[model samples]
Target: MKTLLLSLKDVEQALSMEEVISAVEQGYISYNEGKVQQPDIVSMEMPENNGETDIKSCYNKLNESISVKIASGFYDNGKNNELPTMIGTILLFDGRNGAPLCIMDGSLITGIRTGAAGAISSKLLARKDSKVVAVFGAGGQARMQIYALCQVMNIQEIRVYSEYTEELPKYKEYVERNTKVKVIICDTPEQAMKDADIAISTTPSKKYLVDKSLVKPGTHIVAVGADMAGKNEWDPEIFKGAKIVNDSIAQCISRGETRNAIISGIIKESDIYAEIGELLLGNKPLRESDDEITIFDTTGMGIQDNVTAAQVYEIAKKKGLGKYFEFI
Candidate 1:
């Protein structure tokens, strides 16, 4: 069997934010319609190594292939070794005969799909008139989150917050150079979140960074950093008397932002309003009113990886983008 090897550059060439957002939305729809077979995320934590790796896989009935993605984050890599903090890979196989189709770099895919998921959630949950956006991290994911939101909303101002004071200026320059959106660097998380129509937390913080006092009533929060148990971005009290939705209930309850809330008994499992899939399938409403606080917890999903990897493979194959060789 022949297998294609796609590099990070090749993956970047094959995928676009506009195309990815639509594909991700359809992935959610597929999950809602019971057309995807996905398993819970399996993870290994190595505190000694200052890193963690997660494995997720899925099979979409409408697609001809199945995919498994392995992603890792070594937080100290940037400071210790001058390497990127995160890296990932994806393997796609033919579903029928289980032929190895391709192995591709998944770092960009992971970030883009995550950003796309936020965009999808924002469209379905955020108020139609939402314009201002606050991003709580000055990293790649934060940049992509803003870019993805711009595709679906008319964003006029962007507020960025980061504990790394030096990184914030660089991030602001990057945003200004790439997009027309007005970028502002805030000194504190509360300053960044104030009066924001939409807020996204992309920092990897073990403790809560956003408090309920700073969040406005009509704001929509996209909690992205808490993809593992014991990781969180906001206080459990934020979920009190608010609408909560998850990308996957089982995954979110165990790993996402809701994990802390659930474990603390601040919120019950039955308190979940609905899944994003249900919203896409029209089984549940998006936002009940403009005054309601809505939060979407995304723990990352195998099905997202599956659909995204499949799309990249097809595009690369058609464009003759990646290196192909016999692997089996």
Candidate 2:
């Protein structure tokens, strides 16, 4: 059997933010409806190097495909090795015969799918009149989140906060160049979040970056940083009286910000409002009131990778985008 090899550029050519958002939305619905088989993430930590790696896999029965992703985060890579902080690879397989179908770069897939999740959640939970956005972090994922959000919301201005001040100008320029949204660089998280309609956190900070007092009553918060245990960005108390939604209840309860809130005794497991799928499937209510504060806690899910990678594979095949080789 022959397998296809897709490079990062090829993957990028095959995907658009809008298509990815739709695919990820359906992936979540499949997950919620018990149409996908996703196992618990296997994680490894290298404390000495301040690095961690996670292995995630999912089989989508609806698509008849399986995807396995190995993603790593070396927090000091840029400072020490002048390399990317996050790197990943994914393998796509035919579910029926267990034959390898494709091998592709996963970094872009991860970023887009994660950004799509944030956008999907914001679309369903954020107020329709939301215009001002506050973004925490100034990295690739941060850029992706803003780009995806623009597809769903009529954002007017973006307030950005990052510890690395040097990247702020580049992030601002990128946003202004791509989406023409006004960008403001803030020295503090509170300043960025002040009066913002939607706030998004995409850093890998181990310490909490947002305080409960900074959040307004009508603001929608997307917590994207805490995908692993001990990594957190929001104060546990912020979850109080807020409608909490998660991408995956099992994953979030184990590693996302929801875990932190549950561990801190600020909220219980039953307090969670619904998974993103429930909202997409119309099984639950969306933002009921403009004054209601909503939080979307996503730890990232394997099914997102499965459906996205499957779609990318089909697109690449139609475009003759990837190299083919016999492996077996």
Candidate 3:
């Protein structure tokens, strides 16, 4: 009566950022090759928060589903110290037999995989000569975003902004010693975003933190926040001007930042240029000009979780890492 058990802390020790990116890429390839299945991202409305949205996606591509729940103003309620406000789980299933594979820590896996997704997207979509990177939201996810970008680009500066105020200065210190780039904590999100070669938003906000008017033409934006229906980071006008890239359009529309823009009539379905995999696989094209803005709206792909979890499972299984017990 024994089964393998893995904890969140255990998963953290088992995987690295580079490995997560590789696994996510596998899920991406599986998706493109018609080897995966992903259910549409479905939205659930919350009663008290008009702007609150919860979205879930089950990926056939990686036999995974990522459910992200967003609740804004929870910090405003003076309960900011409890469990993390943005909370959810990623379920991983065995691809070959559909057995429940491993349930690792979602938040940690999220930080790694989502950041890797941005890194991989930038690898395929960002300009080859890009230099500066700016990130919005100075939380843990924001830190990881900067970490991932550093893996793929030789960034000159990193501008960080957060409405949270207290986190920015600490974030600046964390990046300075860890990275070779110049780290600046901006007073406003707009100040961080403008004229940057690459931009990433990791906030869970209902309103747009990135205005279309502020973006420099040809800037590559990888937006990771606003996965829920009512939550969004980039303005709809931004969608109008840029060539949009997504992980999956169907999943993107229900829970991703792109979903908000489409829901509000800011962009059309036909506007999406292609999935990031398409570009990586050579099925689509990259930026043709230095003036056309490109946005990668990421809604945590399932394959990302599946591949990463699968890797963790193999390593943990071999190491005799987790306690085992029989489930049935």
Which predicted model would earn the best lDDT?
2
- Per-model TM against the reference: 0.98, 0.98, 0.87
Write down the lDDT of every candidate, Cα atoms only.
0.91, 0.94, 0.74
How good is model 3 by TM-score? 0.87
Where does model 3 exceed 4 Å of error?
42-82, 86-91, 95-98
**RMSD (Å) of each candidate, 1 decimal:** 1.0, 0.9, 3.4
Question: Residue-wise lDDT of candidate 2 within 12-86, one digit each (tens)?
Answer: 999999999999999999999999999999999998999899999999999999899999988888897988888
Q: What lDDT is reached at residue 84 by model 2?
A: 89
Tell me the spans in candidate 2 whose CA falls farther than 4 Å from its real position: none
Ranking by TM-score: 2, 1, 3
**Model 1 Cα lDDT, one tens digit per residue, 1-328:** 7899999999999999999998898899899899999987889998998999999999888896789999999878878787788899999999888999999999999999999999999998899999888898898898889888888998899998988777788889888777789999999987898779999999889989988899998899999999999898998998988899999999999899998998888999999999998998898778989889999999999888888899999999999998989998
Order of the predicted models by lDDT, top scorer first: 2, 1, 3
What total of clashing residue pairs does each candidate reach?
A: 0, 0, 12
Better of 1 and 3 by lDDT: 1
